[model samples]
Target: MQNPAIPPLASEFSDLPATASHGPLRIEYRWVNETAATAPIAVFLHEGLGSIAMWRDWPQTLCERLGMRGLVYSRPGYGLSTPREHDVKWPVDFMTAQARDILPALLDALDIGMQERTRMWVIGHSDGGSIALLYAAQHPDELAGAVAIAPHVFVEDISVESIAQTKQLYETTDLRNKLGRYHADVDSAFYGWNDIWLNPAFRTWSIVGELDTIQQPLLAVQGHDDNYGTMAQIDTIGERVPHAQLVKLDACGHSPHRDAPDALNEAIATFIKSPSKAPTSTPARSPK
Candidate 1:
């Protein structure tokens, strides 16, 4: 449960114009430490099945600790943002569309111009991490750096297995009801992500070939015990981007922020402060 003492942050909405494939959308977002007008912005992107509510107070806590302003928002189909039609399905290039079109449009809607964009940093988890990497690759000069936690550059058998299991849990258990609290349309959020990943055509989907274009400082993190993906995910990132820093946590799983907050926070703070000097791995710590 979220701490009742920490009230929900004020939220604002941005309207994104219709694109070639979809209608207009209203994105739900909030700012952390907005008073820090001069500080660089740290944009927080959630996991595939995450939303602004699912993120809770972590974004605020991290921004305060780092002394940086932060941006947290729900993608079109999650949170209070516009939900997808029940009959519609996300495309194979859905994540790509987010990185290439939706994110930029949100920035524009918020009046964040090119100048502010260049001073920004993207911190993302899971599917969001993959989107961050894609954004970095497509617009190398728009951001200062990027941090990808448990991001998948290429689909693995383990990923498929885990996702398949999650589908079962969603159908047979109370997963839907649990996730419903964070989203206005839980089925949209769940199915959009689950359907695409389980799609046979998506098995070959990989962003490894596009990562060579990213020139900014990059940090890739994964848990030694992550069920959704393996260290090979970040290992491949390091191989592609020589300067990329890789951090593998012990006793952690798919969600580092929830499982190893202290270590994850420390690593992120250190790397964002001194991108070149970040430790390659954090010492093993008990999962929270």
Candidate 2:
């Protein structure tokens, strides 16, 4: 696909300084709150190809609504952050790398650990949703709650097929150009996510078993028309995690925050502001 001209609004976060590298990559992030207020800290994790700028003002809006602090950043290989130089693909163990290595390194670098002094709330979308799930499952003690939008608990055939189609779009259409506006180097962000999800070894991936380990409160959401994943993704989460809540929005696509911002904001604010106690059992499925 021919690259598109960078959008005028694309450089909104260009001036934000990058944090010193605690690992091989230098992390870039934007903080909405400087004061150590009583409101919980909500960390916003973008989608596979998403960056701080691509998120627009959703994080800030949510933070203001809930009177909470917001932290937004791009993953190592995406957005304005450092990119991997090799042609290596994202391995089947990508989730493990994120859960055990990248996330901790970023948190430590930012001096934001799971210590009780800081109660953290994770809001992750798409691939980020999976990362949040992994983090919450591994360190349930560190998080107050998690909200995963369009999370994939298992590698479904449909997901692989969709990714394959995306590869074709990247090659034959202007998809690359559109992505370039959100990422400094679209290829690094694109292929790092694309190649890994479509890898043959990724077919055997499943985090369903790990869901049982997540003792913290969880809100699993998906759009009825989400092209990237199906209701089964969120369903499996509720089935395995007794305390999990499921919400499906109608007329919504893969990107709920973009397609249905009002509904998404309401759902998140409600979940985040609610009492920390987990429900006795899974809430009844409410599919919009």
Over the stretch 185-210, how does candidate 2's per-residue lDDT look in tens digits? 78988888888888788888988888
Q: Candidate 1: lDDT of 90?
A: 90
- Candidate 2 regions with alpha-carbon error over 4 angstroms: 1-23, 35-38, 113-118, 275-288
Best by lDDT: 1
Clash count for candidate 1 is: 0
Instruction: Tell me how far the alpha carbon of residue 83 in candidate 2 is from the true structure, in angstroms, after superposition.
Output: 0.7
lDDT of 2 at 196: 84
- Please, what is the whole-model Cα lDDT of each candidate in the order they appear? 0.89, 0.77
lDDT of 1 by residue, 150-200 (tens): 999999999999999999999999998888888878888899889999999
Winning model by TM-score:
1
Worst 10 residues of 2 by lDDT: 10-19
Tell how far residue 29 is off in model 2, in angstroms. 0.7
